[model samples]
Target: MKRIDVTRNWQGSRLDRFVRAHIPGTPFGVIQILLRKGLIYLNGERASGAARVKGGDVVSIDIAESDEASPPPATKPKRGPGKRAVKLPAAGAAAAARKKLRPAAVIGRDIRVLHEDDDVLVLDKPAGVVVQPGNRAERGSLLDSLEEYRRRSARTRPRGGAAAADAAPETIEEPPFPYTPVHRLDRDTSGTLVVAKTRPAARALARAFARRAVHKIYLAVVEGVPAEEE
Candidate 1:
């Protein structure tokens, strides 16, 4: 611990500034270290670096012997003492790189809902939008839209985003409402679609599609051949 006498020379000066002026070779960061460690005191009480030093103020500092002998960190000599200015790379390159990471598309406003109930929602799939994210998917797909729609349509948010546990006495049940697509259409395909609003409903609809139980028909169909009564 080193104690420094505050004289008229340091009157009205900040503690950190006074320390730096009196101790020429010390780095400014060292004073911060002492202040943060509760090692700096003024008038026998802990003080911050920002405290003002008055005449006859006895400032005490806890510091190692090496601290006094240590040399100041070397600074790079300023380029011509003031003409130093670093050049930054062009903004276009950075913008292009950022663009690649952003979603390739935003959900369009044209999505039309055809049917909605407790367990399912049927929509008119707009063409040129993907049913799911792909290897190069940037803007996201139809699934992204459904997820966003569900969040917005929810009347209340459950605790921790989970369904409220208070609804059940024996066990806490997680909120189980999420919109999931039962099947996928091509990115550019437009048609009637079915979306499940609950996990059980999703599973049932998925199974129906998997087992070829659900029937789909496209009005004004194009680019397909009809079975010739085979």
Candidate 2:
């Protein structure tokens, strides 16, 4: 059994959907079965799939890791010389395609923080790093880097002695989902990205975006000249 804390990123998400996002390659039917068996728990209590999860909630998933791994795709020989065609399962194929979009491993320092506060974190996202996980298991995203930075900050934070005692309690407390992208930039697009640190902030930002209250301006550079009315 594994326990996953509900972060602001997944706040207000349905239990089943939350589990689905966290546990990839697992069939939906299996999740239902687990729920029926009371193998899944929310805050140490049996929960339904339709229940909503909030930040700071603890979810316990009692599922075997083997069940999470999908069988390998089948392969067949093609008509061409020394060529073969592989048949991938629908879910597995999609997951594989998503995984292919990820770049090489990235460290926390790669992401630049433009602005940070209790409610939001703005970053200068670099080209080639994804905004979030393409798949549940895939990493090397801006979100991952933010988490890494949070972890590093926690490790370096003052501990013990009078200096530590004088530190703010909130600083020493475990952060709940340090970053949740309210908007997304393409993996190849390097630009300013806004992330929410609290669920209320996330909701407000989402509403603002939905209402088109936020304005965005983009700049592009081209090296070659275009043809003259060709």
Candidate 3:
């Protein structure tokens, strides 16, 4: 039995949907066949098509040796500033610099900050709030708020150091300003979210999740009653 640990990023989706997303290039009919053969298990129990998953559930599926061929690696985004203008402080004066470097305005009308620290920010995203901006016609998003957070964070740091000064003007670099997401909650599901302020922290959190070191609990309302244990 091949095992794969699920992450918080996979929460709120159906078991079938999650399987399809992770096992790329496999046909839907193949997945259905695996399910019928008792090859897929959710938390050590048989899973059905309709089973809804939470963040920490374990999903295991058996794959034949013919299917073990490796997929191509995903490409990383380009480095450098990408020609975008960095909002400069006014007049090159200290006071003017401080005033000009203020954080961007918060968007996403429904989002609220739950907790904040020098290394992270936690927000209670409302059910309908979108985390990132969409098409040109669409209005308000979480990315706007994150940009504001980044700007504010950048303004507070000293103007020295190789990584800090050499970092892309448009965005912060690793260690100090890595701009990473530790985990993500669904846009429609409102709950706690953890954002990493630095690259090392982000990597650490990712490893923790992969190792199943993080634990999560959820409250759900079901429509049926429990059967007695015989």
Candidate 4:
């Protein structure tokens, strides 16, 4: 096993990000696999890429000497008229284009539902899963599974309710939302995700997240104890 010590500049970055910056020739997918297989350890404990690191943390890994690769070159931003507007196809064209898209079935094994209510659904997104369809990927994503599940659930769930006969015009609203993501996570950052099942819920959840009303916490394992508390 080879060991590396984290420096002050690398503190607070994701352990995986730090590895990629320092270790060359190892792809992220490989690193994740190695982590799962007990080939990688942080401070003598098995660690996930999502682990956060601090200065003086020790990383132990199995890698070749020649794999001391350099960091990848930075990508240049695309030049366009401001930001290029994504032109969604027209209705008829949209239908035709969608016909060519992959079948809207869950390509991955399953959607791990953590919680579900009338307004929102919570899921545990696995590390390797994508939340939505990518430009080049043919596999369906978590979004596709949710869409399919919603479509089927609508057939069983009751949609009819007592209509308020005396509602004011100002209170009227648009239609209910389809399954929509409240926020996004990087493809490899496996964690809890909240999705809105209705428009009202979406707005409320978005506001809550944006305003930092929701309490957030992170767990990490450091290689060595800090000499002083900050």
Error of 2 at 206 (Å): 1.1
- What residue pairs clash in candidate 3, if any at all? none
Question: Tens digits of per-residue lDDT for model 3 on 100-167?
Answer: 43452232464555544455555556677666556856656666667666777679867767786677
List the candidate 1 regions with Cα displacement exceeding 4 Å.
1-108, 135-137, 156-171, 175-177, 219-230
Model 2, 43-145: lDDT tens per residue? Answer: 9999999999999999998767434443334344344775333221232332343355355233474766655555666666788888877788997777778
lDDT of model number 2: 0.70
> How well is each residue in 187-226 modelled by candidate 4, as lDDT tens digits?
8777667788876577767866764445444555579788
Instruction: Name the 10 consecutive residues with the lowest summed lDDT in model 4.
Output: 85-94
Name the better of 1 and 2 by TM-score. Answer: 2
lDDT of each: 0.67, 0.70, 0.61, 0.66
Against the hidden true structure, what lDDT does model 4 obtain?
0.66
1-230: candidate 1 lDDT, tens digit per residue:
77889999778888988877766756666666667677778989988888999999988877774365444554554557535333212224333433553433223445666555567676667888887776655655777788787877774644543454545457666975768777878877887667788765776677556544454556665677877542
User: Model 1's lDDT to the true fold?
Assistant: 0.67
Instruction: Return the TM-score for candidate 1, rounded to 2 decimals.
Output: 0.41
- The alpha-carbon lDDT assigned to residue 206 of candidate 2 equals 85
- Which regions of candidate 3 are displaced past 4 Å? 1-110, 133-139, 156-178, 221-230
Q: Which structure among the candidates has the greatest lDDT?
A: 2
